[model samples]
Target: MKAIFFILFAVIAGITAMAITTEQTTIEPLLTEEITTETITEEPTTFETMPIVGDEYCTWGPSYWCHNKTTAAECDATTYCTNYVWSENTKGL
Candidate 1:
């Protein structure tokens, strides 16, 4: 009788452990992409009027004020270029 009780106790403990261990779970993706295709029509709020200068090509140099309105024929007629072209066109002697 004692041996039978021990065996029944062991089976009940194993069934209780298995019941406590069994759990449902859900897996999810790491990233979720959201698609948007709405045309955003932005109205012009501010106006930046550039002072119109000469329509000639200006020498893009240190002293020349070659801006957007000023063409290539405007400003100084020197062959010197602006200092902004460092990596793009860094020429040497």
Candidate 2:
């Protein structure tokens, strides 16, 4: 009947309209390759003798040398490192 024909026409029109408007999507992964190289050798480092500081001297103190002087703030000021003759490291007379 006319109702059946109209129903078929409406379904065909809807399907055609959707096919024209909808989008198709696809995904792909990126490709990569590995590489290798030869190893290189290095020379060993050598240390030089430290120069002795003057009269302040190092001695056998509580920790290192007895020759160190304590600051008023109660901190180790060894960087200046004077008083080599009296330091704990040296063998003396």
Candidate 3:
């Protein structure tokens, strides 16, 4: 009878330990902050407002304000070039 009681006590303690050791779970609060972003735009450029490469550039002798000349012309018509001749007969004036 004593042996049977000891076994019963051991079984109850094991069951109680198992019940207390079961996995536990907890609830956590969620982040509620708002996020935002911004986009940027750039302006377009106009080629007409910019200076042409050889339009008024010239090269060779006394400079003259030359206008549109043939691409085959010897010198640029812009003020940038040096040593060029000016004539009413210049191609493309």
Candidate 4:
């Protein structure tokens, strides 16, 4: 009778240990998510005009045009017109 009781107690202890280990086991995500990123770049637009003579001017500051080179230079110096260009002949040929 003592031997039978020992066997039953061992079985119960083994089952309890198995249940505790199962509960403590870590669970992994079934579906792992991968993240990806992309970068896009665009070209700047260009302004074109016909050539002229003696009517020099400068293009600067958000599509603004200056008829004087000095003013254009000032705008450039102030960083207001970083991409200034000189155009000729406002009065046309």
lDDT of 1 at 31: 30
List per-prediction Cα lDDT, in the order shown: 0.46, 0.47, 0.48, 0.52
lDDT of 4 at 86: 37
What ranking of all candidate models by lDDT puts the best one first? 4, 3, 2, 1
lDDT of 3 by residue, 69-92 (tens): 442244543332223544445434
Error of 4 at 9 (Å): 0.1
Q: Which stretches of candidate 1 lie over 4 Å from their true place?
A: 24-93
Model 2 C-alpha lDDT per residue in residues 1-93, reported as the tens digit of each score: 999999999999999877766532121121232333432244557889876664343333334442334531133434433434334554231
Q: Which ten residues in a row have the lowest lDDT in candidate 4?
A: 84-93
TM-score winner: 4
Q: Write the per-residue lDDT of candidate 1 for residues 1-93, one digit (tens) a residue.
A: 999999999999999887666532121231343434542355558988886664433423443443321431354422333434223343221
**TM-scores for all candidates?**
0.25, 0.24, 0.25, 0.28
Candidate 3 Cα misplacement greater than 4 A, ranges: 23-93
| Candidate 3: 10-residue stretch with minimal lDDT | 23-32
Clashing pairs in 1: 56-73, 56-74, 57-72, 57-73, 57-74, 58-72, 58-73, 58-74
> Using alpha carbons, what is the TM-score of model 4?
0.28
Could you tell me how far off, in angstroms, the CA of residue 59 lies in candidate 4 after the best superposition?
A: 87
